[model samples]
Target: MRISLICIGKTDESYLNMGIEKYVNRLKHYVNFTLTIIPDIKNTKNLTQEQQKSKEAEQLLKQINATDTVVLLDERGSIFKSIDFAKYLDKKMISSTQHLVFIIGGPYGFDNSMYDRAQSKLSLSSMTFSHQMIRLFFIEQLYRAYTILRGEPYHHE
Candidate 1:
């Protein structure tokens, strides 16, 4: 199954982008991974936080297929240890998911409809990180999960 990470904004810092790219490239050996960045919403000054999220939600919803399994990277979602996350991924692969889509919403997070459409939600951590930084962290964790699955030495207990 293909894995897609859909985030709302770009990571402007070169270092962060490089780190994200490193994991994305490494992930290719294990799964079909794609990092899709939805363009930032225009004219945020004119919009309320809710409106911005609603707009981002619309764009995010457009990226998924009806058959795709949508998982949101929400702070309030279930948290899992790295090894357990690998097991969780194995479970999804065993279930024959066609495409697994994990989304990182805009600054204000997801809208109600987006939440309503998700099959599950996952939290990288209870501690918060910047949206731009989360891309690197999430991608690295994804790579780590794959390595743990394969018994690679990249991740330590």
Candidate 2:
């Protein structure tokens, strides 16, 4: 199975970009992983929160395929430990899932339409995080999950 992270906006901080890239490179050794950034909406100062989310939703939908499994990184979603995440990924691979997409929405979050299209929702933590920071954290967690699955010493109990 292939895994992709679709997030709104680009990572502007050089430090964060470097860290995100490191994890992405490590993840390539275990699974097909890619991070795609959707451009932020223009003229958002005049638009309402709902309008901004709608624009983001349009962009998000365009990237999706009919067979892709959509999982939203929502604040209220299910949270799992690294080992459990490894097991979840193993199950997806065993089940032959074609493409598993996890989306991180914009500042205002996802619209109702986007929520309707999602197959599942996952929460990295109960605390909130910046979009750029989440990119690094999520990718690192993915790498850790893979290492755990391989019985590597990278992850500790």
**Tens digit of per-residue lDDT, candidate 2, span 13-73:** 9999999989999999999998999998999999999999999999999999989999999
For residue 31, what is the lDDT in candidate 2?
91
81 Cα displacement, candidate 2 (Å): 0.9
For model 1, name the residue pairs that clash. none
Segments of candidate 1 deviating more than 4 angstroms:
none
Q: How many backbone clashes does candidate 2 have?
A: 0
TM-score to true structure, per model: 0.98, 0.98
Worst 10 residues of 1 by lDDT: 17-26
Candidate 1 lDDT over residue span 33-141, tens digit each: 9999999999999999999999999899899999999999999999999999999999999999889999999988889999999999999999999999999998998
Find the 10 residues in a row with the least total lDDT in model 2.
88-97
Alpha carbon deviation, residue 139, candidate 1 (Å): 0.6
